[model samples]
Target: MLRSKKGYATALLASSVFLGACASTSGLDGINDATINGSHAQAQGAMGAGAGAVTGAVIGNQMGSSKAGAAIGALVGGAAGYMRGRSLDIKAAQSVAYDARQAGYQAEVNTAVMQNPQTNQSQQVFTGYRVLIPASEIRNQDPEATRILQKTAELAIQADTEVVASGPANLRDSVLTMLNLPAGQAQYVPSNDTKVAVSVMPRRG
Candidate 1:
């Protein structure tokens, strides 16, 4: 059973890499389109200005009416937009929480971009993972406990993020050693709490 669980985790990690690549590409395409559209809007604005100057009275009345309409629409849509964004944030938080609960741990997830030294560019490189493992898991050594910790470490490494783990010395050391975590990629924090909390966060500029 342990071996099968390990295999499943390995397969998930592999598949996630491929899916992540696809998502990145799609995101880049969207960014590009938005940039291009912004430029296009600027050009159109300049053209419209010239046309409006040539037909000032007609254009002025049209602009005034449109501006009034836009203001009213903005008032109507603002609350909806806020609610939609809040809903998305809630769902993302709930998703990680649910996953962690299933694995017999507590967790949080976040996303951020980091600067790249090569081109002096900032890119969305990683999704953060924050996990908490109960102390009883350390005392009892159940398969679920081991699996969750192992999965957390694997995901942090996969995302190329730094992991800060706080827990009992023995539990922390054993988990770190088991994962063979790189010195630069992982950090240990001293904690008196009976639970292990691991935070995986992206590098900041």
Candidate 2:
């Protein structure tokens, strides 16, 4: 009887710690930020942990050991998730590099700072400056402006294929006009300043 009670106590303690860690580390913000920033690792980790915890807890409970099951599940799930996430991140980085080259950028990996106007949160994304540069610059008549315009136009075409618009109302409108995109085709992303706009495209499965 004493041994059974001790086992129960240990399981309860393990379960509490597991639950607390999950609550503290992987909230909605963490998930949303990972997705927004293209941090496949973080996103995958969060997903794996959540799925693993649930599965482990269920199995453990069935075996009369809920706490231990949850703890084990979390560790196993996190590892698997990270591995999958790493694969996805690599593919995504390659795709971005390809897009940069096609858009007339240096074909190098670059980071852009993006802000969510609604949430007022900032995130770093992997993309070329052509997608992040100011529209006014692209509109100038200088030779540099011409080059920027061409690159922006390339991104605009991709955006037209399938992207939703978000960001400053005025900037979004200006981008639509500058790119000559039809109504509802612009994918204006929010930035720290009004002059710069950004767009993010979803990866198709």
Best TM-score among the predictions, by candidate number: 1
For candidate 2, the per-residue lDDT at 203 reads 33
**Candidate 1 stretches greater than 4 Å from native:** 1-98, 112-127
Clashing pairs in 2: none
* TM-score of structure candidate 1: 0.44
lDDT of 1 at 183: 85
Candidate 1's error at 52, in angstroms?
Answer: 35
Task: Please provide TM-scores, in order, for all candidate models, with all chains considered together.
Answer: 0.44, 0.34
Q: Report the lDDT tens digits of candidate 2 across residue range 1-205.
A: 4544564465455434432332111101111111113555567768887887787788677767777667656766665564455434433444543444454443332333333211233434333222444445544433543444344444434422223433455565555555565555455665546344444343332
lDDT of 2: 0.45
Residue-level lDDT of model 1, residues 1-205, one tens digit each, is 4543443354344333422331231111111111111122123334433443344333223545433333323322332222232223323333444556777566655534333221233344324556777867765776777776665565555434467888887676766764467787777877798987877654442
Give me candidate 2's TM-score against the actual structure. Answer: 0.34
